[model samples]
Target: MKYRNLGGTGLIVSEIAFGTIPILSGDVPVLPDYYSPNEETAIAIMEHAFKLGCNLYDTAIVPEYGDAEIKLGRFAAHIGREKIIISDKSRYFIGDEMYDAVNRSCKNLDTYANIYFVHQVDENNEDITFGRYGAIDALNELKAEGKIKFTGVASHYYDVLLRGAKDKRVDILQGSGNILERGMLERIESEPLFKEKGFILNKSYAAGILPHFFRIETLLSGVLSYPISSVLVGMGTNEQVDQAMMMKTENYSRPSFSQVMSVLEKSFVPIPCDRCQRCRCKYGTEIHIIFRQYNYYFLGKDYWALRKLDLSINESAAQCKKCTDMSCMKKCPHEINIPETVQMIQRLVEIHIRKSLI
Candidate 1:
């Protein structure tokens, strides 16, 4: 496995960091699938990944990742804690909550995390996470206390990540990208501010859905082409570890975003939105994230995606219909028909909800 500098951290990390989500045995309703390996089996899988040159092991606190952190702690002890880099995270955004969360994470891992992130940050809580005595402040405090070596902000939206890039407190950024949802990654690559911090990308397979539509190598190579420090792949079985670790990251020609969309088009009518987060609704709706759920619904996350859509589609679609403003379309580089697409998404949700009742 090749290595890259975890930007400005001076720490070398494997191109493929081991994602600990799938190894946890739990009924995590959010995920469409999980491996549910026993504790011994989970540790073995992580250790195998380590032997394959994967030094970065990423996990979250209990209940979020369902005991994976504890298992990773055991694996770290088995392998000697000094040999690997541990990345831990929690969803807390308040200063006190974040402070306590990091301390809990350190105890769960039996060692301080090399980097800790405020996971799943979004526009709703971005201000709280970055504000005075917020999560970032807590992480900074933790860093000074030697509880964690670095601070990070993990979000799916580009605007939030850009704020993180601009903030001197943020040492690393985590986000999702894949061959299909490469829009945000494309925008990130062009922005110079991001180069100052390290980027670790997850959902390279779009939460394990894209692999059914595209080759794993295709998905891996597409995101690997970016300047990201590491691309995380969720591994459960040892075979999966081999499949991901053995691929040659360099010298592989990656398909363009259009080419990836074309392949996906053969399966279903893909929403043309790249999730760039540029199209803002005068109403508080997150347009790019709605588009992402629409695409994910067609990509095999029907239940989870539709559930997310149910939260705002009705209201957003109503607002789209009532509004006369066309600025969202004007801002879109792709020139996507935002109003029409949102209405179509509402229809999809209605149709799916009706079908499920039958």
Candidate 2:
């Protein structure tokens, strides 16, 4: 496995870190069965990955809750913890809740994490993350107490990551970057803060859409071409572990920017709204969020993605009916019929809600 320095943490990590979310089932409300492997298979895949030189393991609170950490801890004990790097994440927990979550994570993992992350902090909720008794404070306290060696922020938003990097408290920054999602790659290349901090790129398969080898190769090549520390892959099977190992040792040519763009365009699923933000609602409706949620739902076909959309709809859908002026449709760059799309999404949400009730 190719190794690289993890930002300024003085720790060396494999370029392809093993992400463990796909390995276990959980009680997380959305898509509980999605990507879950049996315990035996999960353990075997992880062990095989370790033997193949994948030294970094990342797990988050969602999807598997603490199950992934417990399994990882058992594996760590068997293989010797010192031989691997453990990365854990806590999502939206703050103050005492954050402390309790970390404590539980450590206990479940059976060792202090080498890197602990404030998972999924975004620009919209920056205050909740950086405010009093927020995730940052909790992470800082954990670091000071020596429970975790380093603190990092995992965000889908570049602006939030930039803020975290500038805070100087964060030792690592994790973001989603793939051929389909190249915004983070561009930000990392151009932004000094991203260069200065440890950057771990995840969602390389665009949340499991690009499962075919050819698509994976194109996406991996595009991401590997960037100057980042590590690219995380969710390997649920032995074949995937082997493929990751092979990719590291193989001399595959990286795809050009234009080629990557071509692939993305060819593979792209059409989402009518372009998120111009020029579309104004008299009732202050967030139409862009609806479009984004629908995009995720359409691409993933997973209930978790839909659940998020459901929540967004619950919050914003009411306002759409109140808008007298159909100004959003006029403002759309693609001139998409906004009202028709919103109604379609509303019907889908209603169907999902009815099914869940049944």
Candidate 3:
């Protein structure tokens, strides 16, 4: 596996990392499972990965729901405990939350994870859960006291991720930038990486749509890993582990101009609304907002936790209906047929709801 300075943290992470979300929660065959790894399976995967020189492992703990760290603790005990580097999440937790997460990570890993992250600090324009710990004031104290070796963040959006990189207190940054979540990448195109720090790129496969999976609908999904430094991936079974290890360096062939444009032309997925006004009244009407409203009215229960990402159509879509305008559709470079897509998304949401209710 190739290794890089990881944004100059003096820590050289393996290019091919074995992400442990599967060991935490087994969610999907393709998506990293969120369950804890079984004993025999854990031993097998860890052994294969280590044998191949892929040593970095990352896991996270949500206050409400997760068993990943506990399983990792057991795996660490089974293994030599100190043979690999561990990266775990500790986002936005306060006094008790920070203390509990710190203690849990140590106990679960059976050793100190070299790095602990503030998980999801900038999601939905929210303050970090570990606001107290995220600053130089607190983290410097903790580092001096040996609470954690290095501090960093795992974020979904680049606006916050970029700010985190500029903060001297923030030593590492992980973002969703696979072939699908390129939104983050586009934002950072002009800016430099966290010089002298690290940038661990996860979701390299674009969730589950990459490699060995069919194309067409899985636009956000991909099998290709970009030319980025380190790409973190998860394995649920032993066979999958082998593929991750033995996979040699990819011979990348950048697409021709037409090919690139064609791919971009075909690969646009509508941004789900979260009631945020980021789009403003630009579309001359609310497009995604309209979809979100119809979604809730039509498919309410099916969207439970998904509600966190809903976009409000009260203004945008309502404006669209009031005026003889449809500017958002024209501005959409993908030619998404915005009005139709929003309506379809609403339709799909209702269909899911109807299935569940029936």
Best-matching candidate per TM-score: 1
Ten residues in a row with the worst lDDT in model 2?
27-36
- Give the Cα error of residue 195 in candidate 3, in Å: 4.2
Query: Model 1, 1-358: lDDT tens per residue?
Result: 9898998998999999999998987768886467889988998999899999999989899879998899999999999988999999999999999999999988888889999999999878989999998999999999999999999999988889999999999999999988777788988999999998999999898888888898788888788888899999999899999989988656645697688789889878988887777777778877888988888888888878877898999999999998998678887877889989999999988876537735
In the range 1-358, model 2's lDDT, one tens digit per residue, is 7888987889999888998876767665432224567767777888999888889998875334537778788788888989999888987646677787888888888789889988877656678788888888888899999899998888877668778889877789888766645645765677676777888988787667655424566667667778788888887788878876666335534565455445435645445543434566666566766776676565654565566666667546566666567887775655777766777678878886437635
What tens digits encode model 3's per-residue C-alpha lDDT throughout 213-243?
2232232213223334466777666666677
TM-score of each: 0.96, 0.77, 0.71
Model 2 misplaced stretches (Cα beyond 4 Å): 29-40, 61-66, 212-214, 248-358
User: In every candidate, how many clashes are there?
Assistant: 0, 1, 43
Ranking by lDDT: 1, 2, 3
lDDT of 1: 0.89
TM-score of candidate 1 to 2 decimals: 0.96
